[model samples]
Target: MEALDTPVLDNHLHLDPRYGRGIDAVDDFRRLGGTHLLVVNKPSWHLDVEASEGGDFRAVFEETITTVEEASEALPGRAWPVLGVHPGLVSRLVDERDFSPAEARDLMQAGLDVAAEYVRAGDALALKSGRPHYDVPDAVWEASNDVMRHAFSLGAELDCAVQLHTEASDDLTAVAAWAEDAGMPRKKVVKHYAGGRLAGPTPSVMSEKDRLETAVERGEPFLMETDFVDDADRPGAVLGPKTVPRRVRWMLDEGWEDAVETAHVETPKDVYGIDTRATLSR
Candidate 1:
């Protein structure tokens, strides 16, 4: 396939050197014409950080920043970091660690504060937060929403985007409301692992033919992502790192050059305030 002129940015991705391909996975994407990506921090357990306090999350955030730095060195100015507590940590704290719902919520909110510090220090570009995608008790659900809103507050204060991992739903109106309530723009609340039917919040749709086509046809600005878990145990679980660039090539082949520019260049810039063209030029 011919290399696309537009930049290919995977809005959500992971790299785990201890358990997965790590830089090699990133190299795969780069070799396939992926010029930019956001190396989002995985769950705390992925890095073996058993955090009972906010500062313990530092280990996870630092590891992610290191990965982004390595990726940028390989593909200059092409990789940025998004740091925050994974919403699942709430359940992990409550069930696995024996914390109460309120305690778990407080710890997670504090963890997000630590993530916000990274953004403040210019070490990260965005914060990741969302409620669980599975069934949970109402108390856990409420606590998770509180945690998500705390992230929004941090994003508002830091002037950065918040990438969310939430349940796939046709109506995300309440999520939008949460962002608005926290003084963050709804567009800055990126719905990671999203589909085309989301009614509110910016969608970071995975790289699938039907989903990409659907998002494009909807005439709403959205971002593209691979959601590569980068776990050796789950190789290519969600999608591969090469997916976005390959999808870009397909979009160009199918005469969706404008969509390529929109997803890769325009939407990312609008949401995260990062310019892929500028990154490429660097």
Candidate 2:
């Protein structure tokens, strides 16, 4: 309906070593006139799988949380981390050494239990997803309900959002499916691109046209996963940084100015749990 400016939120960004070089490392995240940058509230959670298998789960969990708290305090406003048990965390629980499907199922169920209490109980939102490429077991799909409901409740109160990767580009589908079981709020639901989509295909690659059309038909708001890292070359391409802006413009060109709300780039209100927002207005 209305033409908006170039401001947009890069919904999915990772603070890996490549991006987190120094204090001013995040300066580039704001290059496109973004508003806020949401990051992992707890990065240790993402790495727990490796630690659990090689080191100690209990120690890893404790160390991860502590590090997250400390980092959140340091960053203050640049990083907004979504907390929850990742599927990668569960993959560690199985400890098949091979990371088999059946083992993934058992660990997936455990993660739901952990998520229900730790994450659902005001810890953080869990960002778990299963990929057919990974050949993951059905257990993960079955356990999503128990985990999502808890995560959503926490997110609702904290004024935060949780994203689920259930094999779709539209936020509504992922939100609806999660709501059916977890009762998550649609208002907080944001659409995102798949992390591995760049390696395999574009969001519009296979079910691309359909998902884009569905988002248009339902007036669904879309967000970008612009930090996707490609592995095709000696050094993969950053498909999102270049592709996301183009897609957003394309959607606007196709007449979705109002239907698809662009996520404004923003700074984290707080780093870990610090009061970075105190400086900014509500």
Candidate 3:
């Protein structure tokens, strides 16, 4: 198949050479016309690192930045890092590590602080944090929201985006409220794995045909992502690395060229404040 004139961007993806295809996965995306990636850091435990303090997360963030750099080498400035403490880690801290809920929340907030430092230092483009996507105790739930609030505040201070990984919900008014309280703009907060237009933060719609069509028909600003975990054990768990480009190809084939530019170029640029054209050219 011929590549489209416009570039495709995958807003959320993970690349781990130790457990997955790593650079080869990135090459897969590239080969399929995906020119840009927002490479999110996996949970700390995924890297076999258990963090007690903020500094302990440095290794996790650094490894993610390294992956971004490596992906960029193959695709230039098209790849960027989004680092943060996964909300699920709170459960691990409390359950396995035997830390109290408050302590776990504080540690996750500190880790987000570290992620902000990376964004401040120009190593990453955004910060990521969200509440658990599953059932949990009330205390754990509250602590997770607290951690997410800290991330919103960090995003406010750094003037960068914050990608959320939360339960599937069409309504995000609570998230919007927190972002407002933290002085972060609603548009700057992205809802990863979104289905369609949300009431709160901008949706980063996953690459599913129905959702993509819905997002386009709505004519509201939204980003597109594959959420590719890149795990060999669960190959194409969420979606393959090539999904975004392939979907973009569908958009173009279906005569949704304007939607392509809006989703892959304009929306991401507005949220992350990056020059997509220049990055794609590089």
Q: Model 3 reaches what TM-score against the true structure?
A: 0.97
- lDDT, model 3, position 90: 87
Per-residue lDDT for 43-154 in model 2, tens only? Answer: 3344434432322233333443444344344432333444344544444444445555455444444443443344445544333333322434566444444444555554
Q: How accurate locally, in lDDT, is each candidate?
A: 0.89, 0.40, 0.90
Give the alpha carbon lDDT tens digit for every residue of 106-130 in model 1: 9999999999998999989999999
Error of 3 at 4 (Å): 1.4
Q: Worst ten-residue run, lDDT, model 2?
A: 198-207
Q: What is the TM-score of each candidate against the true structure?
A: 0.98, 0.53, 0.97
* Native-referenced Cα lDDT, model 3: 0.90
Provide the lDDT at 271 for model 3.
92
Show where candidate 1 strays beyond 4 Å: none
- Quote the lDDT for 89 in model 1: 91
lDDT of 3 by residue, 190-217 (tens): 9999996677999999999999999989
Error of 2 at 267 (Å): 16
Ranking by lDDT: 3, 1, 2
